[model samples]
Target: MTTHYNVQKHNTIYQVKDRILIGTMPPKAQVIEEAPDYLGNILKYFSKPRTLEDSFKFITSNSSLSEIEARNLVEELIENKIISNKKFDSDNRYSRHSLYFDLIDTPINAQEILANKTVGLVGMGGIGTNIAMNLAGAGIGKLIFSDGDTIELSNLTRQFLYHEEHVNNFKVEQAAKQLALINSEIELVPILESISDVEIFDKYFNECDIIILSADSPAEIHEWINSAAMKHGFAYSNAGYIDSFGAIGPMVIPGKTACYECYKNDGDLYKFLDNGQELPSNLNESFQAPSYGPLNSMVAAVQANEVIRYLIGVERKTEGTRLLINSQNYKIYEEVFTKNENCKKCGHFTHHTENLHASFQESSLTDVYVNERENDSFNSILLDSMMDRLIKVLPNTKILDIGCATGEQAIHFAQKGATIIANDISEEMLEVVNNKVNTLELKGIKTLHGDIVNLNIEDKFNYVICNNVLDYIEDIGTRLSKFKGLLTENGTLIVTIPHPIKDGGVWKKEYYNGRWNYEDFSLQNYFAEGKITKSRENKDGETVISSIESYHRTTETYFQTFVQAGFKVVGLFEPQPPNIVAETHPILFEKCSHIPYFQTFVLKKE
Candidate 1:
C-alpha cells in the first residue's frame, strides 16, 4: 500500500548556493551547505506526494540523515505548516489571512503557532460565539467549546453565528457548524454540556493553553474557575458584559499575575473567595445580566486577541489589566489588578483538617453508578434492602455516609425523612449532590466537601454507611475508630464490599512460581516490588482517557478490620439479584446467584 502526501505550496521556497529557505511570502533561508545535507532535501521530498515510509527511505538514502532525523524534519514542517498537503491536514486549505500575524515579529509561520495551540471557549453566548469566530479565523489549531444554552429568537441580535432556523438548537453545535464553514482547517469539539464542576473542568481544560470564560455563569463559578486555573497553571480570561457594561479583564496566569479575586474587590463576591470556599450552591443563577451584542463582541474580540498573544509567547499587556467599555458612549478605560497577599485562590492559605487527605482524582461517582454499575441489580437491591431494614428499625434516625460521592444512600434516607450527612474529597461530587437535593426538594440532607477519613463533625448519628470506600484506604482502622465514635450508644454501621470468594482479587491470568503469589498482578508497586497496584477508568467525556488508582483488599480483611475496631458483626447479608437482572442479563444473573458480587453487613458496637 502507498500513501501520498503533499507539502502546502502556499509557503515560498528559495534555493541558493546549496542553501534552502521556506516560509510564508518570503522564505526563511538556511545555509545548509555547511549544515546537514538532509535539511535541503527535506523540502524536495515534501514538494510532491510520497508515502511516509518512502519519504523516510528517500531522505535517509539520499542524505546523511538517520531515520529519526528524517521523521523529526517531516514533523517540524507539519508543525510549522510547511507541509499543508499532508494527509493529516486534508483540507489542503491555505490560510488566506496570514499577513496580519506574519507582520508581528515576522514569525516563520504564525499559522503554525495557532495551528499548534488549543483554546477552550466557555459559553456560546454573544461573547463566546464571537470569540470562537475570531479564534477560528486566526487559525487556532483547535477550539474546545461549551454552552448550556439553545439559540433563542432574541440571540440573533448578538449571536450572529445563528439564524432563525437555528433557534432552539444547541448553541455549541450551532456555533461549531458555523465556525467550521468559516475555517474547515480548524479542529472544533463542541462540549454539549456546560462545564460547572471541577472534575469536568480538569477533563476539558487540562489540554487547553488558555481558557476563555464567557459563560453566563455566577460570580462564584468564575471564582471557582480562578481557583482551578491557579491549581492547573493554565491562563484564563474573563470577558463579557453585565447589562451594558463590558469588561475584558485581568487575564490570569497562575503563579504569575494577580488572579480574578485580587481585582474583584466587591465584598459580596469576596465573602466566599476570601476563604477559598465556594459561595452557596444556590447562588448559581443570581449573577448574570443580559447585554447587547455589540458589548459582547467588544469584550470577546479583546479576549480572543489576548488568548492568541498568550499562546504565541508574546508579552501580554492585559494580564492583570481589565479594560472596561461602556457601549452607550463607547468609552474605554483600564483598571489593573495586583497580587493580594490574602488572596485565597493564589495566596498563602491553609486547608482545613477535614480537607486534608490523599488528593484522589475524582470522577463522577454518581455518573459511573448510573451508567455502568447501577444496572447490576445487586447494587440497588443491596441498598434498598439495607434501607428497608433500617426504615423499620430506626425511624427518624440521622445517617452518615463517609466517602460519599454524589450520595445515593444520603438522598435515599433524606427522602425517607432521615437526616443524612455526606462527605467526600471531591468538591464537584458534593456540588452535584447539592443540586440533587435542591431539585428533588428533599430535606434534612447536608454535604461536606472533604476527606471522609478525617471527617469533621460532632453530632452523633444512629447509623453510618461506608460502601466501596474502605478499599481505597490503607490505614482503615483509624478512620473506622472515628466513625464508631460518631455513632450513639448501640448505633449500627452498615458496610458493603465485594465478596472475596465470589469476586476474588483480580488475579493475574497467567502466573509463575507459586499459588500463594496470586495476590499481585503485572504492574507491581515500585517501592514494594512484590505487591501489585491497580487502576480503573473512572473518567470520561474528554479526549484524554483518565484513570484512578485503587487498592485491592480481601473480604476477610474488611471483616477483621471491623472486628478490630471494637464492632461485632451482628448480621451479614448477600442479596439475591432483582428480577430485572435475570430478564436483561440472565448469564450474569446465574453467575451472581452462584456467588453474589456484593456482601453487606450490619455491625453493632460491642
Candidate 2:
C-alpha cells in the first residue's frame, strides 16, 4: 500500500492504513526530515504493536530495501520521534512485538494492557527461564533476568534458553540473549548473581517495576525479600511447584496487602509441621520431584496473568493471601491470614537496618550500590521464632497494619494467608509496596494513603497492629482511638512500643551499617515528622528522637491510656535483641533479658 502525503499550507495529513489527518499539526510546519520514507509501511505494521517483527519481515521481503536497509529505516524513524520503536532496545529471536494475540483474542482489554513495563526475574533456571519467556511474549517492555550460575548441559531439558553452545555462560546472560531473540522489543538485562546478594538486590530490586522470586533460596531470603519489598515498596510475586501437584501463590501489594511471612505462617496449613523434627510420613518416596514442563509452564503463565491484571488496574476481590493449587488433592484452596504483630523487621523495633552493606563501606561500590533494607543479624533467631509464634496464634485473620512503612508486614501477612490493608502517610512508601503487590499476583491486599490519626478504612478487621508507631505520635490516645472505627467487634489491637523506663532512656549512636559506612538520612526528612540533625556536642543527635515532641510514657502511662480508650490488655510481650539484655538486675549494665524486651501489648476492644 503506497501512502502519499503532500505538505500544504493549512493542514498536514498523515496516512496510516487509513489517512489520519492530525488537525493540530499546522500544514506549513517543516516535516521532521528524519522520518522514514516508508513510515506508511511502519504504521500499517504497527496497527497492532505485537506484530512489529512480522511487519518488518514482510516489508523487507517484498521491497527493494535490504534487511539492513529496513532496520535502518525503522531506527531512523524511531530516532526522529516520528514513531515509537517499541523494539528499539531489544533483540527478537522467536517473534516480534507486533505479533502477540491482542487482548480481544483473550477476555482482556487491549487498552488496559501495559506495553511499557519492566519486570525482573531472580533466576534463569527451569522456572525463571519459563517465566521470562511468558512475560516477554506478553509484551512487557523490559525483561531483567538474574542468575549467578552458568548454563550447564543438565539444564537443557527445562532451561530451553541455553543451547549446547551456551553451556558455560551465565544463566541470566544466556537467558537474556534467548529472550531477546524471542521479542526484541523486550529489553533484557542480565544480572549474573543471586537475588539475595546485597550488590545484586540493591541494583535490581528497586529499579525493576516487578520481581518474581523463583530461586530455591534459604527461608531467610523469603523474609528478606518480603521486608525489602515492603521497605522499598515494590511488588513481588512468588510461586512454587512441588511433586507436580502442589502449587503456592503468594503476592505482596505494598502497604495494603498480606506479606510473605503472613502466608508462610497462615496459608501453608501443613507448614512447620515437623518444627525441625523428623519427617512424619514416608511420602519422601512418593514425593519425588515431578516433570518440569507442566509445573514450570503453568506456574509461569499464572504469574504473567497476574502481572497483567495488576498493570491494568482490574481490581480483584481476593487481593492478598495464598492460593493453593493442589493437583494432588484435586482441590484448590485459599487461606486468609494476618500479620505477626511482633514481626521484628516489620514490627515495632525497626528491624529494617536501613544500611545493609556496612562491612563494605570502604569499597567505593558499597556506597554506590548497597541495599538499604539491611537488618541486625543479632536478633534473627529471636525475631524468626517470634514471627513463628505470632503467626501460629493468629493463623489466618484479616489485619490492618498502621504506620506500615513499605508494607513489609502487610506482605508477610498476605503470604501467611491473611487479607491485609497496608496503610502509611508516605506516598513514596506506598508506591514501592504497590509495585511488589502487583508483582506477586496476590489477592485481598490493598494500600491506602492515611495517617494513624485519621484512618479511612470502611471495613473493620479482625486485627489492627501498629509497630514502632505509637511512640512517634504526640497524641497517642487520639491517634489510637481512630482505630476503633476500623476494628471488628471482637478484634484485637497489637501495639509495640519501647518501654519508656528501659535502659537509661533512648540511646543514640552511629552504628555501622550492615556494610561498613553510615546511613543516608537525606530522604527521610520528607517522610518522618522530625528532623535528625548532627549535634557536635551531643554526638549522633539522639537517634529515634520522637517525631512529635512528646514526653515518653512509662508502662503505667500506656496501661492508663488503654483503659480510657476502652481496651483491655490481653497480652504484654517484650522483645530483646540477642546479646542486649533488657536490664542487669535493674542496677548493673551487663545482662540482657531472657524474654523479648520491647513491649507488645495485645489489647481487645470493649
Candidate 3:
C-alpha cells in the first residue's frame, strides 16, 4: 500500500513502496535506475548541490522500508562509501546531514525546476562560505560570490574552507575552489570586490534570483541592497551575526512584510547600534573560541536551509521576516515586521513632485520650552539650530511637525513668526501640546491629531519638520512622499533620525534598550494610527523603540527616495554634537547640497 505525504504545490512526489517522499529534484537528477550505482550516481547529481545524506533521506522516505530497513539502507550507503558519516551538532543537538536537506522536499514540475536562479552574498566569512558550499553542493548550476578582500590566516577561526596554504587568495576565489572540489558539477563565479560601489551593485543585481546579504559591510550597504532587491522585485535575504546572536530571512514579498531596510532602520538597527558593545575583534579572527566555528556554521546552515526551501519550492512562510538567534544562551527568536507603506526603498513616494526645497516653521517664545528643563535641553538645541537656519532663508513660512509629540517644535516656530500646524497620532500628545499652548498664550500654532501618512489638510505648507520620528515610522519613503503632497510648489521637508553613524554614546544608545517596547502601539492614546506590533525588544537606550508607526532611512536612501518622489536636492548638513561631547558625524541636506552628515536636504516640488 502506498501512503501519500502532504506536500507543497510544486514539490516532486516519490512512491517507493509502503512509504512516500516528497521534494524537488535537481535539474539533471532524473530517476534512471538502469545506470547502476544508484547511491554513487545520486551523490554525483548536481545542477545545484546535494549531499550524500540527502539522497539517503529521500530514498528511505520514499521506500517501503520500516525503521530497521531504513537504518540498514543508510548503513549500506555508508559502507559503499556513497555517503560519509559525520556528526553535525549545533547548540547541543547532533544534526544529521539529512536535516540540512529537508528544506527542499517539495514537488515541482520540470518547467519550475529549470528556471534560472541567481544569488548574491555580501560577506565571504564563515557563514558566507558555508552557505555557498551548501548551495553549490545542491547543484545550483551557476554561482556568484563577491568579496573585496583576500583570504588571511586570521580567517581560519571559523572560515573552515580556507587555510594557511590559501592565505593571500581572494576569499571569493578560495570559496569557489572549495565548492568546486566538493561538487565539480556546479559552476561558480567570484566577484572580488565590495558591494558598496553602485556600479558593482547594478552589475550583479539584475541577474540575481535571490540576494543573500551575509556580509557586515555597513548600514548604508543594506539600503543599496534593499533598493536593488525591491526595484527588481527579486528576493533578498539579510543574514549575519552580532555577538553570539544572528538572523537569516528574506525580503521578497513586499508590502505584506517588512523589507530589509525596515529591519536595519527600524527598532532592530537602533537596538543593535545602541547595544553599546562590539564583538571582540579576535573572535572572528583565528584566535578565539571553538564556538566561533560551530556558531558561524550554524548561521550559514540556517541561511542555506532557507535558501534551499525557497529554491526547491518550499513556500517561505516567513519570507520578508526576521529570524533572530541568540548564541550566547542558545535561544532563537523570530520577529515579524510589516513593510512600511512609506519605506524609502519600495514605499509609495515616486508618484509625485520633482523639485527639492528646505524650510522650517516659526515658533513662539513659550512653545520652545514646553518640556521640563531636563527633557527640553536636547530637543531645544536641535530646534534652535534648525530654526536659526530656516530663519536666515525662508523667514516667513508655514510648517508642519509630524509626530509633534508635545507640539514643542510647533510652539517654537510660532514664536519665530511662522504659522505652525503640529500633528500627532496621539490624542494625549495633542492634548499636552494644547495645554502647553494655553499656558504659554502661544498663538499661530494649530494642533491636529493625525498620522503622517494621512494628514488631510487642505492647504499646502512651505516646510515640514519630522524630528526623531522617522526611525519609528513604518515607511520613511511613504511618509516623505506624503510630505511632498503637503508641500507648496517649492516647499521643503526636513527629517532628522537618530544618528545611526555617530560613534561613542550614539552607538552605545542602541544596546541600552534591549530590543524596543512595542506594547504601547495598540493604545490609541499613544498613537492613533499605529500599525501592528509583531516583535519588539528594549533596544539600546538612546531611543524609545516603539512598535507603533516608525521607519528609519539611511542618509543616501532618504535622499534617493526624496529625489524619486519629485524633490530636487539643495544643501545637506549633519549635526555635530557640541564640540565637547563626541557625536556621530552629522549629515544635513538642503535642496541640493551634498555633504555627508547634518544630512539636511533642501527640496522643492517641480
Candidate 3 displacement at residue 237 in angstroms? 0.9
Tell me the tens digit of each residue's lDDT in model 3 across 1-606: 322222122334453543333344554123424333343323333112335445447655665555566567656544532334332234422123234333333442311342356666767888888888777766666777889888877789888888889999889878888888986866678888877755566786667777788765553676677677666776777777766676666445544556664445443444445443432233444533233777888778888877767766666744755666677765555555555556676575322111111113343323333433223243443444664675433466788888787665677778878888899887867888898889988878888887767656887888887776766666667777788888888777776654333210111111111232122111122222324332211111112222233333455666677788877777665654353221221111110022112344566775
Candidate no. 3 TM-score: 0.40
User: By lDDT, is 1 or 3 better?
Assistant: 1
**Local accuracy by lDDT, each model:** 0.69, 0.58, 0.58
Off by over 4 Å in 3: 1-105, 108-115, 250-256, 269-291, 348-606
lDDT of 2 by residue, 1-606 (tens): 333212221223465443443324333223433444555555555544433466568668757788888777666645533444233213534223222322112223432255667777777777778778878777777777777898878778777767899998888777777887887876778876676544456667676666887875644677677777777777777766655553434566766565765445443334445552422544566544554665666666667677666655654323464444555443444544444555544442221112211112122211111122213221232333454465433555888888666566677779888888888877777777788889997796898896856554678888887866786676778866887767889887888764454312322223221111122212222223322222111111212222223335567778989889989988887755444322212211121242223577888888
- Backbone Cα, N, C clashes tallied per candidate: 1, 85, 118
TM-score of each: 0.40, 0.38, 0.40
Tell me the lDDT of model 3 at 450: 70
lDDT of 1 by residue, 1-606 (tens): 666766654546666666666553434422334535556566766777777888889888888778998888777766766565433333535334454454355365666877999888888888888999898888899899987778889889988889999999999888888999998988999988877677667887778888888874544668677777877788888777645778786688887777876656532244446555544565566754677877778888878888888887877767776666668876555555667777777885322111111134454455665444434434554456665765433466888888676666688778778888888777777887888889998878888877765656989988888877766666879888988898989788888765544434433421111111123323222223112343333212111114444455565677888899999998887777667765565444544565556778789999
Order the candidate numbers by TM-score, best to worst. Answer: 1, 3, 2
Candidate with maximal lDDT: 1
